[model samples]
Target: MRRLFILLLLVLSCSSKDTLPDITVKDIEGREVKLSDYKGKKTVIYVWSRTCAGHTEDLKKLSRLVNEYPDYRIISYAVAMDIKDVQQSYQQIGIKPNFITLIDPSVKFNDYFPITFLPSTYLFDSKGKLIASYAGLPEHL
Candidate 1:
């Protein structure tokens, strides 16, 4: 029981903060990207995995949001997945959003962001502060 309490304490302390880790993912063209690249701009970080119908619908929805809100700087990034899978996910779903797609093949994001569910999204405001974070697809369009 004592060990369990300590483990729980560690886990709770690890994930206490909501701010995203300073992680950079690469685009399809192999450009090293940092989260702070677009300072003073809002960013939408989408963490999706590629598989049979895995978060495909959510991607499409986000694509629509990108299209609808062109004025807002929206960046949809694929986390915990490879470039191939990230590209394939878009191709397989036939979704062409007005946002940039990125890759994190080594599942490095999972270490920082506890993304147990697919289609997890993080909304960062103009100051690069994490404004809102959602797990799974948000019902509000």
Candidate 2:
């Protein structure tokens, strides 16, 4: 019975890590935004830092995805960067993102979703369950 209980605990812990946590984060405008509010839509979160390479191209691709996939919610989460820097990067790229732009100066989201590397992309289903995650830009996007 003890072995079965341990196995069940392990399974539960592992499965819980795959879902988006009900945490609040800040948007570019410094407004409190709840991650849970994005539920009921196919969400794509792109995590990037200011120093990360290929961000410019990735942002451009994300812009295309925003237009191409209207059904999916594309979110650009900038970590360890100031709001001004994030805004500047967008302006420099010459593309206004039609999707959501969030700022994570302290990388609070990492606690829920482990981001081992920069420029990571995560896809979640309408139910807030993780569908797929890519270390770099996914070619399909």
Candidate 3:
């Protein structure tokens, strides 16, 4: 039974990873948005916190990517953060991000993503399958 259970766990783990879960996160306006909403559209799901300096840098790069890749449907999630508190700081720095950056205060997606090692970004194809996951900011188009 133990061997069978282990085997089952491995299979499930491998299987689940292939398809990104349909998780619900928030937008800058505090509205609930689900991952399924972006299905069939190439998505860039990023988990970030307002406090991380790395994340701050990443956001600058992300804005550039949005302008470069307007053809692709990019969704940059500002998870585990509140944009209101830092909006002035974000703007005072002259950083205007074009992509939709969501705010996830509920920590709902924490189970699937790591909060501490944030600024983690995920790329999904038009079909909503996770194609790439970058730990920091992405510089490439």
Candidate 4:
């Protein structure tokens, strides 16, 4: 019975790690928004850094997905030094994202999402459960 209890606890802990936490992050305009607010829609979070090259191309691909998958809540989560850095990067790339863009100065979202690399993509279901994750831009979302 004790071993069964331990196994159940381990399962719960592992499963919880796969779900998106209800944490608050700031938008590009510095407005606070809760990640949980997007729970009802399929979410695609593209994590990138301004210093990382080649993200602009991936961003373009994601832009296409934004229009093709209207039902998906696509977000460009920028882990930059500041909002100005992210803005400058966008200007350099000459592309303004059509999807939602959020800023993470200190990378607090890493605690929940565990971003090991720049320009990573995380796909979550409507219920906030992580469905798939890619280290870099995939050929298709």
The candidate maximizing lDDT is 2
**Model 2 / residue 55 / CA error / Å:** 0.6
- TM value for model 4: 0.84
TM-score list, all predictions: 0.73, 0.85, 0.73, 0.84
Q: Residue by residue across 30-89, what tens digits does model 3's lDDT show?
A: 677775677766777767766666866676777777777876776666655676844654
Worst 10 residues of 1 by lDDT: 14-23
List the RMSD of every prediction in angstroms: 6.9, 3.1, 4.3, 2.9
lDDT of 4 by residue, 26-54 (tens): 88788988877777889999899977767
Candidate 2's error at 117, in angstroms?
1.7
Candidate number with the higher lDDT (2 or 4): 2
- Number of clashes found in candidate 3: 1
- Please give the distance, in angstroms, between residue 139's alpha carbon in candidate 3 and its true position after superposition: 2.3
Candidate 4 clashing pairs, residues 3+ apart or interchain? none
RMSD of 1: 6.9
lDDT string, candidate 1, 75-103, tens digits: 66676677776777678789766677778
lDDT of 1: 0.69
Those runs of model 2 whose alpha carbons end farther than 4 Å from true positions after fitting are 1-16
* Over 4 Å off, model 3: 1-20, 86-89, 114-116
Residue 6 of candidate 4: its Cα lDDT? 100
CA lDDT, every model vs. true structure: 0.69, 0.87, 0.68, 0.83
